[model samples]
Target: MDRDLFRTVKQGTRNQARLLYHRLVCRLPHLLAVTLLLVVAPRLVSTLSLAALWSEARANAAVLLAACAGCAAAAYAYAMSRPRPVYLVDLAGYKPGPAHEATRAQAIRQFGLAGGFDDESMSFQKRMMERSGLGEATHFPASLMSIPVDMCLQTARDESEAVVFGVVDELLAKTGVRAEDIGVVIANSSLYSPTPSFVSLIVNRYRLRHDVVSHNLSGMGCSAGIIAIDLAKHLLQVHPDTYALVVSTENITLNAYLGNNRPMLVTNTLFRVGGAAVLLSNRRQERARAKYQLIHTVRTHRGASDRSYGCVTQEEDDAGHVGVSLSKELMSVAGEALRTNITTLGPLVLPLSEQLRFLATVVLKRVFRADVKPHIPDFTLALDHFCIHAGGRGVLDELERSLKLSAWHMEPSRMTLYRFGNTSSSSLWYELAYCEAKGRIKKGDRVWQIAFGSGFKCNSAVWKALRAVDAVAVGDTGSPWAQDVDVLPVHVPKVVPIDDDEASYKTAAA
Candidate 1:
């Protein structure tokens, strides 16, 4: 993002304007729903009158009026809340050293010989390590690169429950959040379906107050992180002055695909060990204490019936063999999903100029059918920084073009991919941390995070920094990873763009 863009947003109550716009946007859907009701209500009422149903007609009117009033009140309350993310903490734990890379290549080669090779390579692994400053671990194979069965909950049913609880314990220590104060708990694990479930394990482990609202989400892919954030946002509104903990991670052992399909290979090569716990609250008192504030969230899902939903999928063959696969058309599906998500999300956060441009194009294309072209989303207007989904270099390239994002706007996300490999759901947080390390974040700066998942889902969370980090957080072992990130490859370093098809690698001993 350009400094001028940030300056412009701050110049004349633009933040205030953006907030009002979002409040209205939130009500637009409900308003449209009610409008449909209005169109249908009169005719239906008259039809019922023929049956002498006067009381039912009056009751329907009352219900409609009440709903409209409630929506208005909710919108007003949200607009007045004025909550912003305090600071974003991106985790860089489980940094992949060199050994991980060799392991992956070995796995691919061995699997390929048995027709189990989806051609999952160490290319992404190498890029992730170099970007993250993780020297040798990038070469480690899936066997070593992946989390232990115990960690991803691959053991007995009880064991899986125990693993998630153990992680929650670590989370409590990291955030210093007590069990009693937590008003909401959201856990997203797409693979393993343990008995008591992921959320239940966390609540039980912490012995959280019995009244705490808990939600467990499964089946959603990497985008589950932001979906979890949205869920927390709503819970905050329902119970103000309460804490909500959002936990996101994939069960590596469960989702791991051992097959020869190319799409499945992408997953084996990209995903690695990672998990994150975020603390969110709408309470004014918690503002100064919170790490990151909830500015805004947008979720767009192409249903299971949509083409994009099958773009990235796992299925069993007619013979009953199970495996994950990525279609050659996955990128196109992702682009379409992004188009829908941005169309809905951009208007709420972007500036007047960008919105007008977008709107004008829509009008020209749809109404006049003029010889005008559609405009790519102007993300620069809405955010000072961006954590583009690090699904892959190809995915990033497509988004950069689609959103018209500058290279700097993509740096943190790219660097995050380099260091963390795709840590699945937690990758966005790590990318945000990279931006903070680069000294790009300032007080009141807006950060946009976009993540794509298996359902061909696009989920986005917009955050405004309330304060800058005074110093790097204690848990960020990747700090050393960021020390000389500008030049990159601080040790025996060699760097290249991930999209460079011609780039070659020379093996080095760790």
Candidate 2:
């Protein structure tokens, strides 16, 4: 054997031995490290006069090991705990009342507002007026009754198409995401359909690629916003990297019931015109610019029975008069829908405290036979912001009470209803904008959005804000409604009525 080769082999063996020793020591217990150091250190130190050096080294090694353990635990904890960013983005809205006024006036007359109907008609009108909170039924002159159902119907059709296009245009302009880039388009209109469905109108208008997917929801009611969001989530999950466009609106023109049917007449008193288009994408690049990320989506349908399903429906009487009627069973049916939604959503976003409270209530009510049961899960624990469906003042009030939310928490929804009436599915976005405009939302804040509609369905979506929206940047094109809002919490004292001013002014001018 060569002398050089033997030296090289010896050096390689020593290197391998050191590597094996290090690997073994790295896995040793904290106490074991101290034990090993104590057992070995005295031999390495070997002070001539110290016979008990090993014991002293062991005591010092234990303290050093404990310090090292604390640092190691902290490093491990920090590496495992890091925050993820959440984003929420709002798209554009389209206005509804662009139809000619003359057509609207004719619709009012043909619909029986100008003293055309008899006793049965008058009776039904009275009932509807009472239900809608429009005070007692009174005849309005032909000129006074203005909202033409026919013109509204026409506008509903054209406006829905316009809303869809406007959304597409906004997405392209704001995100620089072209129509071809949008993989799915989900457009929802509660009523009225033109020759080319609103979805097709958008695709054709933009000359989108032939393969783009499209869905049109004809009569899902206001809850269609979450329905679309859920659909978009599923599409995004399946299509790797994709963008989905969700547009929500209600077609009020054809939806108006002119007959003396009280249920249908309730719609005439409210329901303003509005539409919203939102663009959602699953791509990482797009998510950076996105305002809100879709956190969780839950949907529940109470269509298990005919009664449950037909709570809100169009009916025709024996006299051949058509109208939409509501069953006394509708409120219970809505509650069922809401119950189903909470069941599905509660486990997803609720905090541990809320979950425990909910579980305790269910257990106490069912198992223990307790005299008192706890309330349902604390929804406020799960969400800092809420954009509940603004279907009506009554609907908003019901949700606020059920959820134990504050008046300020429901202000956005109430204001949305006052401003836009009921824009059907698009109403949620309007409500969200109201919250943003008031500077109520903060970055990383969670928002709970819930909507209910005709399917006896309740749908919900949870969103977390990624950034604080600038107060001045927030826009409400219909801020005229805010003029009616009392800015302070306290209500002003009522003033005495005066009748002479209007008549006197007119008389003096004459």
* Residue 267 C-alpha lDDT in model 2: 62
TM-score of each: 0.69, 0.70
Please provide, for model 1 over 381-476, each residue's C-alpha lDDT reduced to its tens digit, 9 standing for 90 to 100.
Answer: 668888877777678877878777777787776666655567677778767767766666788888889999887788998887877755454445
Q: Tens digits of per-residue lDDT for model 2 on 1-510?
A: 134323433443454466557657655555576898999888767753465665766769978788889979976875444222222345765543324222222322334533334555544433433333121111122222353323444555554555566555665676677778878888887666566778888888888789888888777877988888887777666665677878777655455555555555656655545678887777766656677887877788878879888998766755665656667777667776786677666756766677556556555755676766446567876688888887665677678777889877776676665445567788788777666656677888888888988867899999877777644231334322232234422221222122223323233223
Which residue segments of model 2 deviate by more than 4 Å?
Answer: 1-88, 96-156, 166-171, 473-510
Query: What are the runs in model 1 whose C-alpha is more than 4 Å off?
Result: 1-171, 317-321, 362-370, 471-510
Each candidate: RMSD: 12.2, 17.2
Q: What are the lDDT scores of the predictions, listed in order?
A: 0.63, 0.63
